[model samples]
Target: ELSGQWLAHVIQTMRLTYESLTALEIPNDMLQTIQDLILDLRVRCVMVTLQHTAEEIKRLAEKEDWIVDNEGLTSLPCQFEQCIVRSLQSLKGVLECKPGEASVFQQPKTQEEVCQLSIHIMQIFVHCLEQLSAKPDADVDTAHLSMDVSSPDLFGSIHEDISLTSEQRLLIVLSNCCYLERHTFLNIAEHFEKHNFQGIEKITQVSMASLKELDQRLFENYIELKADPIVGSLEPGIYAGYFDWKDCLPPTGVRNYLKEALVNIIAVHAEVFTISKELVPRVLSKVVEAVSEELSRLMQCVSSFSKNGALQARLEICALRDTVAVHLTSESKSSFKQALEALPQLSSGADKKLLEELLNKFKSSMHLQLTCFQAAAPPMMKT
Candidate 1:
């Protein structure tokens, strides 16, 4: 720490001397030496700082407990949050001028330097996270394993390492990223602006863009991880026993497959809401849409369906829609509507009446489950 501070002081002093010599109209040849020295010292300072920051982040990534909760629901910030906090603090310490130093002692180019240094440190932080959470060569294995969604232990089978599952690690990284972007980065920008730093906007934009891109990638991966198994189960659950659609009777209640799928979907909602409720709607919307689209496709592929069979399928879809109505995007809602339309319509007055009664019962049952799911959600504002 002392050496770093000493290096910063030397760079600051050299910069001041360079400016003073230039103001006096010193010969170019004479000023060039001081300018070169300043450049060299600045490079050394940045390197030392970056190397130190990277090492700290790597150590933290290795040593810190990444899991917030064993059951995967908690209001606490992610374990790696300190990695980012420390990096920002380190940057501030290096760039901040001494309190007693004159404003002129601060170089005009300090704002640009801050922006560059900030980007470098953030990049390092992200790289460390990438390394820590990286999965081994299990892509092919997971792809094959995920196919058997009928298995109750599908996720367990795919991730049996006894550590954080890939999806859970992703959530941790994503939660940290969101916190950094929304809170920490904003605070840093504000601090810089308060110091009359120019070009802070550029820093905020570049950093935010990077984090947002990572957020998007993480969100998509999570959707894939959680949604695929649920969608895969839909087929066997809906078309159980190779039962011909023509022989399908009027629905007694939601099918076991639909019930099981909803339970799983609600469990996913609970998990995400536990870790990051702010992301719950966005995450679940995509998951629901994927499931809805698959159900629609399954309905379209049906070789035969009695009116009662169609009614059963429609009831299942409606139950799904009602359960997650708040999270449904316009696309998901349209998919559900289209899936309903794809079902055979009932013509008899008695059939229509029966459908309505069954629909009402299904809605009531689903609404109760929805209530329970919502009740389980953590408060919106973190304490």
Candidate 2:
């Protein structure tokens, strides 16, 4: 007992001495000498302590907050929530608790506990948001908040000279939320659309535009890839002016190119089709909402161009329109049969009678076509 008490007193004395040395505002030369002395003392003490068991070392470590002085990456005091996340990263795939490592996603034993933990984290994020939203020159009271925002803080500071509108700030929030939970962010996006948050719609348009550009570039690369070697090798000069060999090479190139081209084309088209289906309705809605009434009406007219065409022509037109719209519309959405039905009746004459007869005979065909198009049209918001 006496020995243990003596050791504790020695430790405390060394700790205070170190603190006092650190607090001294000495000249650089004296400071370096003091720092070297402190390091030597610490190293000797640590070497002597190695004789202690692992459990003793661990207990000491736990009691001392050994990592509290980690390089000051942030102005804030050390945060418990961030500490938990960092611990998780350190132990990932290396250490496992008997039940499981605690995590934000682990199932809580009690609903109250789960709710409490969730609310705690949410409050932390909200507080961080408040700090970020303060005036550019406002002093951020980091001690008041919890949560990791290092990257966001850096990014926000770089843009401090410029003003961010509410929508832009909302976009930043949404982007961070996506990095956290993609599916949840998408659900929130849909809800924003439902609630008429048109900025969300604008974001959707921008996303679709990016996807479309990527698809186009990919397709061009694919085509050029397919065309290159075949076209190059088939040149007569390259083949030593052997016309027959040139013919053979061209045919071979065509065969290989077609095979690879077909696969690449399909892949590119599938990606574009998927993106178009996702973006068109969202984008189209925003465009229509923002455009002049004349432009909006023009779009509607173009959509209805063949409403008065002959039965076969109308059927083809309806099919095409439905294809574009179906990507945007929901499954429960009514088919756009009204567009077909809205075709004006012909004025009386032999031509009119012939048209009327044709319409009656192909009404079922028109209905089928309209059903197909309606299924296609109303879903996407693409341009």
**Maximum-TM-score candidate:** 1
In terms of lDDT, the poorest run of 10 residues in model 2 is 64-73
> lDDT winner among the candidates?
1
Q: How accurate is candidate 2 locally (lDDT)?
A: 0.32
Worst 10 residues of 1 by lDDT: 139-148
Residue-level lDDT of model 1, residues 1-383, one tens digit each, is 54555777887777777777778998988877876566556545655665665566556555534434322322223333455455445445344543322331145565466567656655555565565446543421321111122343644323222344577667766776777777766776775566455677887788778778877887888899999999999998877888667787667877789888888888888667655566677778898899999988888888778877877787788878877777788899888988888887767788777767877787676676567345344547966
| TM-score of predicted structure 1 | 0.71
List candidate 1 stretches off by more than 4 Å. 9-51, 67-114, 135-163, 194-198, 363-368, 373-383
Give the lDDT of residue 85 in candidate 2: 39
Once fitted onto the true fold, the runs of candidate 2 whose alpha carbons sit more than 4 angstroms away are: 1-84, 87-115, 123-165, 183-327, 331-336, 339-383
Clashes by residue pair, model 1: none
